[model samples]
Target: MKNYLFPHIFQPIGWIMFVLSLITGIAIYSSIPVFGAGIAETLAIDSAIIGIALGALFIVCSKERVEDEMTKSIRLASLLNSIYAYVALLVGCTILINGVKFLVFAVFNLVLFPIIFVCNFRLEMHRYNKMCEDEEQD
Candidate 1:
């Protein structure tokens, strides 16, 4: 089955937003000492979170140039692999950081799942493309 994706333009926009969000998030974290627990700091953090979430969603949902069954299968495999890896990491980290540190780690860990999936998907796609090229050359 074919999968529908966002317009080609969204991919680059998503990447830009993702980077900007990361920067904004870092800046907010850095400013926490100065701002304390005020509404401004809360708003900044919330905005950064929203931006990052939306950016990741756009990137993940964007269609590939060639959205074939093989590509879809690769995507599914990558997602499953990412989930498995994330769960393993979560379990291990829970054991290692069984305190206030775990709470902090968990917040960051939530974002890692999508990042890991995207990375794995890209790697798989690259490998598939290379294999296809090699086959064609043979």
Candidate 2:
């Protein structure tokens, strides 16, 4: 089978980057003093956003330990689910929010799909692993 994903080593790196950047982004957004120290201006926010998106991309695109058709299907389904969830969010927000808050959400929207996809994919993968373990134990 042909492989297009990143090496498995990148998965851990991506997780690290995703977590650190998410923390940094949260701190900056929440007005945390020490965490936001040094990182200033809109540029800082932009950098964090870019870091988050790249980290999520690496995570979702990285190869699983056992890359098989099942994993591929899981990835595809997770992606589709993410898209549906993202669109629902957008529509709901459009109906319920406006003005500057909406603009902020729009900016953050850039990374939401990948983040959602990663979460869904991880959850499904965990379920699959647990099922496999159960089968092995029986």
Candidate 3:
């Protein structure tokens, strides 16, 4: 199968960046003064955005351990499931939240897509490996 992914190293780096970005974003948001705006303000916003984008991209694009047909199939399934779950979440949030709150949640859902896909993919991979192990033991 044609495996479309980055080198494995990128995955860990991506995780690091993801965490750092969260911390940086929090710091930026907290440090922004009510009345003051300057270079730090702009830098904080830019850095946080760049960090999150790069991190999510790296993690999503990183390679699996064995890029075989089975892995590809699992990845595809996980992606589809994630999409379904995201849509469900969006719908639920839309029904529960109103106005700006719903808009914020929608934005959150957009950013959460990659993270959800990665989580689902890893969960499916783990289940697949467990099944294989059980079969081998049997």
- Judged by TM-score, which candidate is best? 2
lDDT of 1 at 55: 80
Over 4 Å off, model 2: 34-39
Q: Estimate candidate 2's alpha-carbon lDDT, on a 0 to 1 scale.
A: 0.86
Off by over 4 Å in 3: 23-42
Q: What C-alpha lDDT values do all the predictions have?
A: 0.79, 0.86, 0.77
lDDT of 2 by residue, 77-105 (tens): 99999999999998999899989999988
RMSD for all candidates, in order, please.
2.6, 2.0, 3.3
Candidate 3 to truth, TM? 0.75
Candidate 3 residue-wise lDDT, 1-138, digit = tens? 465689989989998987787677666656646324688677766677677778877876787666677887897898899899988887887789998877756645645777687789878899999999999999
Candidate 2, residue 30: how far the Cα is off, in Å: 0.5
- Candidate no. 1 TM-score: 0.82
lDDT of 3 at 38: 82
- lDDT (Cα) of model 1: 0.79
TM-scores of the models, in the given order?
A: 0.82, 0.91, 0.75
Model 1, span 43-132: residue lDDT tens? 767777777877877777787777778987897899899899999998888888978888878767757777787678879999999999
| Count of residue pairs whose backbone atoms collide, per candidate | 0, 0, 0
Number of the predicted model whose lDDT against the real structure is largest: 2
C-alpha RMSD between model 1 and the true structure: 2.6
